[model samples]
Target: MEWDWNFVRQIMPVLVQGVKITILATLLGSILAAAVGLVIALGRRSDNRIVARSIGLIAEFIRGTPLLVQLYFIFYVLPDVGILLPPLLAGVIGLGVHYGTYTAEVYRAGIDNVPRGQWEAAKACNLSSRQTWTRIILPQAIPPMIPALANYFIGMFKETPLLSAITVLELMNQAKIVANSYYRYLEPITLVGAFFLAISLIAVVLMRWLEQRYGRIEP
Candidate 1:
């Protein structure tokens, strides 16, 4: 089919809505994933072997399973057990949890990279564990981790298309609907690609800036 500017214009508004939702899901999921990853990392590093082992096992299970299956479980299976989340909420939870396992390793690495002397000095100063983490260790560890975490968020943004499996009206789902309605796949699909490519390029530029700012840590 010939490229139709008119059809493109007609579909822009719908696709724009989808784009907003796609971005929203990614942002929320990224926040949740960051928090969940930190928690998992800390839990796995606990002094108690049982807590560490349990958290390690859970993280490994999550990392081992496919994200799509997790989404299916959150959106489909949970409804049977009396939990029914909205599609967007379910998708956000699924994305956060599935990626959190991977990000936990990033957190662990960043934490480990902190000089052992820092911990020793904190204890020497009689700093509480909370004060040590907040005032010293985390402030140093988190900066370097930002670039890696941003990379995961970018991956999460790209994976937003998976949200469509749960009926979330993200870009890919909107494109599919438009294509099915007009019996024209080329325009909608192509538009979807263009939107994704454009956003991904923008994200790459931001990621580069983040890397320049926080890619390194001094011992």
Candidate 2:
């Protein structure tokens, strides 16, 4: 069949809405993931052996599980226990948590790269732990991790289509809706791919800029 501009025009608005939802899910999910990952990373480094080991095990378990399974459990299983969450919120949590485990490692690597001498110097200066981390460790640690974190954010963006399984209506879901309604799979599906490719290429370009800006840490 010939490409029809008329049909594309009809579907553009809905698809754009889907694109917005996709970006929203990624942004919110990345924010949650960054917080959770930092906590998990810090917890794994706690002075207490039991706490450290427990947190490490939990991070490994979550990282081992598939993202889709985590999403299903969050969106569907949790409601049975009366802890219901809105679809988008649930999706972001699921994405955050699952990817958070991975980002935790990124955090750990960055943190570990900070020289032991830096820690000693901070203590020598009589800097409180809070001042040490807030002023010294984190600022240095976080910059190098930005590229990896940004990569995961892009990965999460690509994975937004999985949120559709829970009825989140991201780009893929919207594309499916348009195609199903009109019985023309080609245009909508193709446009979805176009959107994903266009955005991902843009994200990669940004990621490169971030990598250059952040440089690298020696772990």
Candidate 3:
């Protein structure tokens, strides 16, 4: 079939709308992931073995399961237990929780890289635990963590398509709707690819900026 500029034009608005949903989901999901991942990371580093082990087990369990299955459980299974989340909320939570596990590991690695002497010095100074972590450990540990966190942001963006499986009207879901309604897959699918590529390119640029900014300070 000949490429139809008219078809592309007609679907442009729909694709744009879908892109909005995609961005919103990514932003919300990333925020939640960052907050929860930090908690998990700190928990894994706790002096208490029980706290550390419990958080470690949770992070491992989430990483071990497929994100799609997690999404299904949140969207489909949880409702039976009286935890009903809207599709968008469920999608965001699934994405956040799945990637939060990965980011938690990233945080652990970053924290581990902090010089052992720093911790000793903090203790030598009689710094409280909170002061040691917030003032010394995190200030140093966080810069290296930025790149990993930014990478996860891009990964989460790509994975947003999975939300379509649960009927979240993200970019891919919107494309499916357009394709089904018009019985034309070419334009909508191609548009989806273009949208993803464009966003991925933007993300790459942003990641590089973050890397450069953080790398100089920490590396």
Using lDDT as the measure, the top candidate is 1
| Candidate 1, pairs of clashing residues | none
State the displacement of the C-alpha of residue 88, model 2, in Å, after optimal TM-score superposition: 0.5
Query: Candidate 2 regions off by >4 Å?
Result: 217-219
Most TM-score-accurate candidate: 1
- lDDT of the candidates, in the order given: 0.93, 0.92, 0.91
- Model 1 gets an lDDT of 0.93
lDDT of 1 by residue, 20-134 (tens): 9999999999999999999999999899999999999999999999999999999999999999999999999999998899889999999999999999999999999899999
lDDT of 2 by residue, 1-219 (tens): 778889999999999999999999999899999999999999988999999999999888888888899899999999999999999999999999988888898899999998999999999999999999999999989999999999989999999999999999999999999999999988999999999999999999999999899975432
Compared with the true structure, what per-residue lDDT tens digits does model 3 show for residues 68-154? 999999999999999999999999999998999888877888888999999999999999999999999999998888988889889
What TM-score against the true fold does each predicted structure earn?
0.97, 0.97, 0.95
Q: CA lDDT of 181 in candidate 1?
A: 96
lDDT of 3 at 79: 96
Q: Candidate 3, which ten residues in sequence have the lowest lDDT sum?
A: 210-219
